[model samples]
Target chain A: MNESPVIELSGVCTRFGSQTIHCDLDLQVAAGQIVGLLGGSGSGKTTLLREMLGLLRPSAGRVRLFGVDLDDPDLLIQRTVRRRLGMLFQHGALFSALSVFDNIAFPLRELRCLDEDWIRRLVHLKLAMVELETAHGKLMPAELSGGMVKRVALARALALEPELLLLDEPTAGLDPDRSQNFVELVGSLQQALGLTVLMVTHDLNTLAGLATHVAVLAEQRIIAFGPKDQVMTVDHPFVTGFFGADRRKLL
Target chain B: MNAIPCLRVEPGRVVLTGSWTLATMLPHLADLQNRLAVPLPAGEHWDLSGLTRLDSAAAVLLWRTWGNAWPEALEIGELHRQVLGRAADLPREMPAAVKHAFHPLESVGRLLLKAAHNLRGVIALFGQVLLDLAYLFRHPADFPRKEFAANVYKAGAQALPVSALVGFLIGVTISYLSALQLKSFGADLFIVNILGIAIIRELGPVLVAVLVAGRSGSAMTAQIGVMRVTEEIDALSTMGISRSIRVVLPKILGLTAAMPLLVLWISAVALLGGMLAAMLQLDLSLNYFIENLPRAVPVANLFIGLGKGLCFGLVIAVVACHFGLRVKPNTESLSANTTSAVVTAITMVILVDAVFAIFTRQIGVPQL
Candidate 1:
């Protein structure tokens, strides 16, 4: 408990012209916990993730990562803070101009310290971890299939060995089998690297397989934040309605 | 925070400790590389058990430092071993880049083939539009009237202010410069003839053509290129709708209909600018200048300018749509195609203007 949380958001509020998304929302994600953020459609799950990434500033309150305010003006502090985290966007926002290899090598090359040999080895290792062939590295982003795009994006996210991994809809478009494989891949990687993952997903299967903690966003705040079983047992309408029939399988 | 990675050369072993992760190793990368470079003594071993965390980047560094093999006597945790195992399993060599040998004649032949292919594409697109036009004539209900009107507004009405500004500036410059020469020869009255013939017959159509090509031509290409990239064009095809009818024909017809009107508008504004400059520079009265314009420049020149504008509009639209439809589903292709569209449209405008000049050489010149 003495260790600071990886991500902390207190009294966060988001408003877009009278429509409020998050109000008085508070969350503290400890290190090495895979927290799945669940919400209904139009509930602003992605917006909350974007806020945590510092892409969208909350209308009020503070967002801190590793005990440092995300709004700090120091360039070096911002860069250092950003370097410790990686985000996988929903659509695998790969650089369309670069080949798969270059896209994955981008963060490593930005470090400006690693030689080509080390980068090559690390990139190939990441590719292997994501169950992709080295031959696939030469293909452009436009040529990749939906599942391959997610894998390549995951590889790129892991390129920097970030302690905090933020995944937005990690298994949205993949087939059931591919999604299961993706869940396993991420779960094992998280275990191996001790990553603190905050993923936004609506898929119950993905949430069941990966999440150590569940944070349900509803009515502009997190209604339940705890272990999956504990959150499922909460006496709330959203909790009861969300896990109605398949509650037994989740535990 | 975990301790920074530290390496010590003890009496009999190299002891490594602390968090050996990419974030921690980045600042001390050079120093670590220097320390790791020293050869271990014959009896020495590596002790990695004291490390708190070992990430992939640090694993790769250690794997390389040990000459791509485990040390003869090493101590490491099971999880760290697995981390290193991933790095150890990577294939040694990268896939080689494909290279093509250069050949002078082959390069020339390729360029010619590419040009011929592009010419064929343009001709095919033009023929498709003609077919679409005929279909629309047969069934008026199927015509894309809304799309056509939108195109006209976008390519023509939206372009008025900038075109007028440029046209006026060019007119004032040419008139002021020519008046100086005419004044030297005691022929100040000749300014009307020079300005009328030049702006009405040539400069008005060519200048507007260049501006529209750089403006609306690039826009059309980029719009259609994005449609192609996002598969919207294919969606149209799946719905039993012809893209040529809906997209291409409207742009070509709309721009063609708008171009002549724009030419007339810009030419009039330019003439007004020239008249003002002439009056100030040479004391030529506006009344005499307006009356003398008709007599100085033949009516045939006005027809020639409108004809040029019509042809330039058609050529620009066709070139833009041709390049647009050819865009591949990628960012690089979209940008390259848009650039090619504007450049080719402007070039085609000049080339068509030359053809107009040659064929109408005998028609437009006043009897001096």
Candidate 2:
């Protein structure tokens, strides 16, 4: 890991009207690590991920990704920094009108510098990476099943070879068998690409083998952050119930 | 990285090794599957000891070739065992394959059933909105005033530029043609009579109705349809909020208020266009055109036009919300409902216009 963190948040505050989601929260993710963010329902795991992705700004703190401040005044700097980050939303969020091929090719096409042949090759390569058949490329998003949608979404996120990947509940809807497959896929993808990933998930099985570090959010801030096993030993009530007392049931 | 992924089968065993990942870019998987499926001996063993690295993609390819299971005679260490074990459990993702052969008659029957079901859904939604309206009449606090005002601005005020442009162009064409024909008949002065009645009574209402149908009608349908897709409508219902009051009623009230105003605005702009064309083609003065306009097209024609506008607005809003709530939780359904809302609203407008023409025939037309 590098000395400078891939992602850094300091003294972050997020509030909606009278409800405060996070107050003076702080987090850091080293390079090439997969960090699973776990929290109970309404614990603001998704909100923190959004803040890190620059989708939502903290009320009173700094959010930095790849050493670039997300709230920078310069639009060009924001765009440049954002281009290096990729996000996979809870639902696929694929363009409905476009075919799977076109959806994966969207970022490349937006760049306008790649040749058609190169774009086609890269898209095919990505589809293969996610274990999708070449014929499936022509299909629309509605025709895909829940598992396929997640795979396609992962492929799209990897299109630009982003250094940091943000995932919103990567395995909320999949069956146990499929969720295991998803976890393996995410694990291998992180290793292969050397991606620094921040994932918000409730699936404990996903955190078992996939996450190098685990961050537990409770009372609007991270109560525990460390190696998955170490964090599991934390004395907090939510942490204990989440990792030790109810591990078998949750997993 | 130097180790190329390769599969070599000998009499006793199959050997696999190399950097097999998405980045490594292996050859076509199907070709590899074919080579491995050539009836290997029953006791042939597999070796992965030489493999430097393995990822899910590569493991999946190997698993698929092995008939979606780990080989019984596989010779692998604990590290490889754990890696391959994860991939072995994946349920084969069955693509949405059309199972039965295509039958034209059966397909046509299915489509008809779907249409009938959709019609029933729209009617039910309409009835719900009507019931909600009755309830609102008794208790008004449940109404969402902010949302109503916002929708009015969206569906009415913002639509001004495009509606004005379309109305003006249509008016220019209609008046220019009528002026030329009237001139040939040596009755050039009758151009005002023709333009006045048509712009105020028929053209203005119909044009505004069609424009709103395409513009605001589609927008309303799309907004509600997206809410349906994302389960926002469900959340509202779960929270003890009536969707009809919070979502549907405001749109109906807003468009109802805006449509008459839009009709009047379109009529004014259209009349201006007609006056311009008359001045150019028939050499009619502005003063004469303005002064003769009230006598040529009585105030009754304006009222009739506004009446049609109000009715058309009600139908469009109701129809848009009806189809919107009918949308399934899919992108295909959202686009489909939006298109259907626009088409249905326009058809209803034309049908209503025909009825309006017959009933108000004597009221708006000036006697010769």
Q: Which candidate is the best by lDDT?
A: 1
Cα error, candidate 2, residue B257 (Å):
3.1
- Stretches of candidate 1 off by over 4 Å are B98-110
Q: What global local distance difference test value does model 2 have?
A: 0.82
The C-alpha stretches of model 2 lying farther than 4 A from their native spots are A1-251, B1-3, B8-14, B27-45, B63-74, B82-96, B100-126, B136-153, B238-241, B359-363
Error of 2 at B284 (Å): 0.4
Candidate 1 local lDDT, residue B105: 100
- Worst ten in a row by lDDT for model 1 chain A: A185-194
lDDT by residue (A28-103, candidate 1, tens digit) is 9999999999888899999998998899999999999988899999989989989999999999999898899999
Candidates' DockQ values? 0.72, 0.12
lDDT of 2 by residue, A73-161 (tens): 99988876776678899988988777888899898687665446445655666777677877888888877887788878888987766
* Fraction of the true interface contacts (Cα pairs closer than 8 Å across chains) found in each model: 0.78, 0.09
Pairs of residues clashing in candidate 2: none
Q: Write one digit per residue (lDDT tens) for candidate 2, span B1-368.
A: 42557788877899987755433433344455568668776666898887766654466566756776667788765665655665664445533324489999999999899778867876787788789879988988877899899989998999899989998998899989998889899998888888888988989989999999999999999999999888899999999998888999899989999999999999999989988998999999989999988888889999999999999999899889989988877787788889989998999899999999999878977887
